[model samples]
Target chain A: MEFQSCFDIIGPIMVGPSSSHTAGVVSIGKFIYELLGDYPQETNIVFYDSFAETYQGHGTDKALLGGLLGMNTDDSQIKYALEKAKECGMQYQFEFENICEYMDHPNTTIVTAKRDDHVVTVGGVSLGGGLSKIFMIDDEMVSIRLSAGDDFSILAKPYQRKEKVLVKAI
Target chain B: MMEIQSMKELIEACEREKKSISEMMLMVEAKKSGRDEDTIIRMMEERLIKMKEAVDSGIKDASTAPSGISGGDAVKMSEYVRQGKSLSGDYISNAMSFSLATSENNARMGVIVATPTAGAAGILPGVLFSLHKNDGTPYKELVKGLFTASMLGLVIANRSFISGAAGGCQAEVGSATAMAAGTIVELKGGTPQQVVNATAIAMKSLLGLVCDPVGGLVEVPCIKRNVIGTSIAFSAADMSLAGVESRIPCDEVIEAMYKVGKDMPRTLRETALGGLAMTETGKEVKERLFCRKS
Candidate 1:
């Protein structure tokens, strides 16, 4: 196995609270938002596995909502995201599923968001040390990782079959 | 029946393995840096100095620990709530504050995990400190213990999984607890087998621990969870040392944790929409502390 550098794992800048719970959640939300390509008219988030049990305690609700609203991981507004969602007229709901019963990682989230004629569904996992991977998107199934300083809008486009793509955070 | 091995043999093996693995990792790092031995040693020496300073501070904090167990103690009390005994929130809060204060102070010296953010940085360190204190372990052992724990984490990073948003608290606290358990076993002179078993125990116990923080802050239940995670690490180590075997391996345990976390709903995985955050009391606190326009 290839040993990873600390910098490769954690990244440059992060906010308080947690990398997995706070930053990872925001990154996942941002990725979903970018995938939708616009502000979601409504979002239906299902917290599977660990997300279901502890989402409330981890501020993931606000963090993910903030991300859907185009908030950065470090935005302090993430704390008031539920209220912000209400203020912005964004509709969202929370539900718990027995993701654990299927024998999976405890920290998994499946987000499905819909905008005008556009709907995106994805699953994300928040690896510790400020790392995360978008395992699936729109049921097309792709693995995408967003690091610090990454722009999801540009990177979300699927690479052409003939195009050479190297996995490096810019 | 299987033959029982001597504890000294187990300790020596762990020491040798830890030394070799750590040396190998450092060599890899050195190769990547393309730096000479002198520079590498100098850098390592500087890091060692910092770690030593943090350990000194930990000792000082332990020396001045309040009467009764501390924040971790309240968490432990909470575990036994079913026995009809409970601690007041003020007492629990004090313990958590003490743990947080010590961890934040340590972070300044660059010692703790600092996780995805720095404010909750104390959780990992507080857990480590509590484990060592409760076990009557030596300071040097604790330092080496962190190294062992980090090694397990490095392996997980290499192999399958470790993420909170990805895997929930299983990856965060679960990973930390697993690392802590492995490190504690190594500190207690356990063999690799025991270390892995301890790690598996830790991971399994908190397979679905969520990353929820109230008002998007790392305070609230987060502090208590850290304190509790440490105690869990201690028991895991002790149990593994006492010949408890996990039916599942560490890697599989981690994988299960990931799968379980993935299946969890957003409400439980840090959304703050469920659990204590969604309670009447939680809503009241949110309104009182966070509702500025109200």
Candidate 2:
């Protein structure tokens, strides 16, 4: 089951207008933050389908930025994320699309971000009730479930490619 | 201790374990996450505190959301309820105000718990706090009520859907309303069977409801629908308490909701392309908002 815990249904305790559009998107952006181990200096976001249509009303932009800045879903600082991004010297842009080629869901976003010399592209779908899944990492199709309760660092470990380690194959 | 797939199985699990739904949920959480009961309850209690904060702030703040479409209604409702002019008793009127408060707070991007989904967040808090106001139920019991709510919501979400984008408003608000109904029954000392019946009744009432937000905002009809959902939840709880059994089983009702949601058109499912979103005022609001933004 995609939803395992009772809290998944009852409590993300998020700043909201939507669980799918806002809270779930926050998790996806936060996933990137955790995976990258730091906030990106520059980022590009593509909001797809319903996310593109009603992103403003739902505060989807603010939620994503808040997460990218390492804010949790419940952080009210989401409302001022755009200003905070500027203060932190984090450059960002948003592109709207009717569909995300990586996923067929209505609530989808693909983000390309740069942190120093390392850059990664991540695609995600907000699956509602503050639940989300990472579908693509650097052009490779991958499935990683991200709920509010999960250890994001662990869930994101498989896709985190830092300095290449000498492999001793067993 | 196995995962539950249906209400029948859930009840059987509860019966076999000789525990209340809340107790069963706690056990399940402990087993699934490997966390102790105290830690789990503390986490839930923290969420409860956040819910209280949202309701307390929302009822007092008369300011509008940045979108300028939703705000101040919760304050107005609260004042009206205080004046004792409402036809519905203080219980329901209080719930309406609370529901409005949380939903308006949601529009403002304030922190609140998503009982099933944020779009439908207000219903559970509205009903729960109202129960507290009218009956003086302790906060601990209400926290347990949230567990009961999650138990019901988990089944419906797993069986059907809970996001408007995926299943229209019926899945979002409808699932929340059903969860609230069952929760109320369980908190009031109703049987597990009764809780299931209440859930079925509440879900059946709003089957096939569309997600049609004006300007693609969670304002307009969405807020009022949440307010109405509290009444439906209370009514469903009362019916179940009074032995009003749903002719259709809870699991089947959830299946029907799934089918209805699957059959819903893309335009009606948060696409802002049909239903109230396509009405004259809805279209005008969209245009006005777009023009302002551009």
Candidate 3:
């Protein structure tokens, strides 16, 4: 089952509007932040299907940006993430698509980010109730479940890209 | 040690252990998370505190949401309910106002706990607080009621779905309402069988509901639907407590909901492409909002 805990149903106190669109999306973005060891200086985010249709209303853009900046789900600063991104000199762009070529979920996003000399593309899906799954890293398919209370740094360890190995695989 | 996968299994486990639904849930959670019972209870209490904070703040605030489409209704409802002329009595009237308060706060990007999903977050807290206000159900009892709600929600979520994007509003609001109904029954000293029956009754009422948020926002109908869902939960709980049984079993109803959601069109499933989202005024609202943003 995708849902395992009581917290999965009744908890994850968060800045809302939506769980699938905002809270869960934040966890996916935070997963990327942990993967990179910090916030990336640049990001290109593509939202698919339902997320594309309602991103503006649900503040999905702000949620992802807030997570990329290492904000938690309940962080009040999430509402001002767009302005904060601009002030921090983080360059970001958003694209909308009818379908994601990589993931098969309605609430899916693919983010390609660049930090220093490193660039990575990640695909994630928000699976409702502040739960998420990272389905792709670079060109490799992987499965990593992200819950709100997870220690993302430790979760990111096994998937952390080895520069030389990644280059060879690509 | 037995895995409670269906409503039948859940009821059976509760009987076998001579435990209430909430106690069974605590046992299961303690085993799955490897956390102590005290820690789990503390965590749930934290969420309950957050839910109460959202309701308290929203009841007093009259400001509109960022979209300017929803707000101030909670204050209006709270004021009206205070007059004590409500037709639905204290339990349901208080619940409506509380539901409105929580949903309005959610639309404003305020902090709230998701009961299964954020789109349907208002219903449980709405009913729980109303119960507390009407009968003096202690906060600790309400916290246990939350566990009862979570147990029912977990079954529906795994057996069917709980996100609107995945299964339409039937899966979102419908699931939350079902959980609330079961929670109410359990808190009122109903049997586990009665709790599952109440859940079934509530879910059956909203079976074919669609997710059609106008302007692609969770305002407009979403907030109001949460308000009405409270009454449905109360009615279902009362019915089940009176020994009424669902014509169809709870697990079968959940399976049916899953099938219906799978057959639902993409346009009706939170894409804002159909239903009320496609009405004339809906288009106008969408245009106005986007035009202003751009």
Candidate 4:
């Protein structure tokens, strides 16, 4: 089942306008933050389909940025994430698309982030009711469910890139 | 325990165990997660508190949302209900005001529990708190009601969908209303079969509703729809409790919802290209918002 827990249906208390658009997107961004071990200094985000169309009203942009800055789903500071990102000197740009070549879901995003000299690309989809899935990491397709109470840092460990591979790629 | 994947299986489990739907859900959740019942109960209690906080805050706040399309209506509804002039009586009117409060809170980006989803977040809280207000149902009982709601929602989510972008408003608000109907029945001591029938009836009522949020904001039709869903939940619950039966089973209703959503045009499935989203006023709202952003 896509939705496994009672919390998947009733919990994930979050700043709202939407659960799938805002709260689920936050989990995906936080997964990327955990993968990088820190907030990336530079990033490019691509929103697909419904996310692309309604990101503004739903605050999907702020939700993703807040999570990338290590904020949780319920963080009130999400409302001011754009200003916070600017103050932190985090360079970011957004692109929109009608369809994602990599994922079939409407609420999908691909984030490419760089911290120091380490760079990573992540593909994620918000699967409604505050559930999310990390579908791709560094061009490799992987399946990781980012549920509400999951320890993202612990989950990201197995997917962490080796220092040797990073050095060679750089 | 075999996993309860369908309404039939769920009813059978409840009968075989001789437990209420909420009790069955709690047991299944405990077994599946390997967590102690106390811990699970505590977690659900926390969510209940958050939902209450959202309703409490939204009821008094008269400020508008960022889009300026919604807000203050919750305050108006609360005030109207206070005057005791409502035609729908205490249960439904109170539920309507509470639903408005929660959805208004959602539109303002306030913290709220997504009872299935944020778009339909208002319906459960609306009905639960109304029960608390009118019938003196304790907070502890309301927490059990949440489990009942989640159990029904889980089946709908698995068998069909629960996100507007994935299916339509029928999946989002429709599922939440169905869950609310079943929750009400369970809270009111209805049988497991009656609870599922209430769920089926509620789902069938909202089967073909579209997700066409004006300006792509969760205001306008969304908040109002959530308010109306509470009444439907109550109606369905009352019908089931009075020994009424749904013509179609709960599982089949869910299947039909899924099929209809799949056949729906992408434009009506939250793309804002059709339905009320394409109205002149709706187009004006979109232009106004985007123009300000640019």
Model 1 agreement with the true structure over B196-224: per-residue lDDT tens digits: 78988988898767755455344556555
Model 1 lDDT tens row, A1-170: 33244333323234444566667778888877776665677988887655664555356687789889988765656777888889878989878886633225556788878876566677887655656678776545566776645688776765321121221211
Tens digit of per-residue lDDT, candidate 3, span B167-210: 99999999999999999999999999999999999999999899
Candidate 3: list runs displaced more than 4 Å.
A161-170
Clashing pairs in 3: none
Model 4 regions lying over 4 Å from their true place: A161-165, A168-170
Q: Write the per-residue lDDT of candidate 2 for residues B1-294, one digit (tens) a residue.
A: 579989999999988888889998999999998999999999999988988899999999999987788899998899988998999888789999999999999988888899889899999999999999999988999999999999998898888899999999999999999999999999999989998999999999999999989888988789999999999999999999999999999999999999999999889889788999899989998898888877
TM-score of 2: 0.96
Q: What's candidate 4's DockQ score?
A: 0.89
Residue lDDT tens for model 4, A7-26: 99997999998998999998
C-alpha RMSD values across all candidates:
10.5, 2.3, 1.4, 1.1
Residues B103-146 of candidate 4 have per-residue lDDT tens digits of 99999999999989999999999999999999999999999999
Rank candidates by lDDT, best first: 3, 4, 2, 1
State in Å the error of residue B33, model 2: 0.5
Q: Enumerate clash totals for all models, in the order shown.
A: 65, 0, 0, 0
Give the whole-model CA lDDT for all candidates, comma-separated. 0.57, 0.90, 0.93, 0.93
Better of 2 and 3 by DockQ: 3
User: Could you give the candidate ranking by DockQ, starting with the highest?
Assistant: 4, 3, 2, 1
lDDT winner between candidates 1 and 4: 4
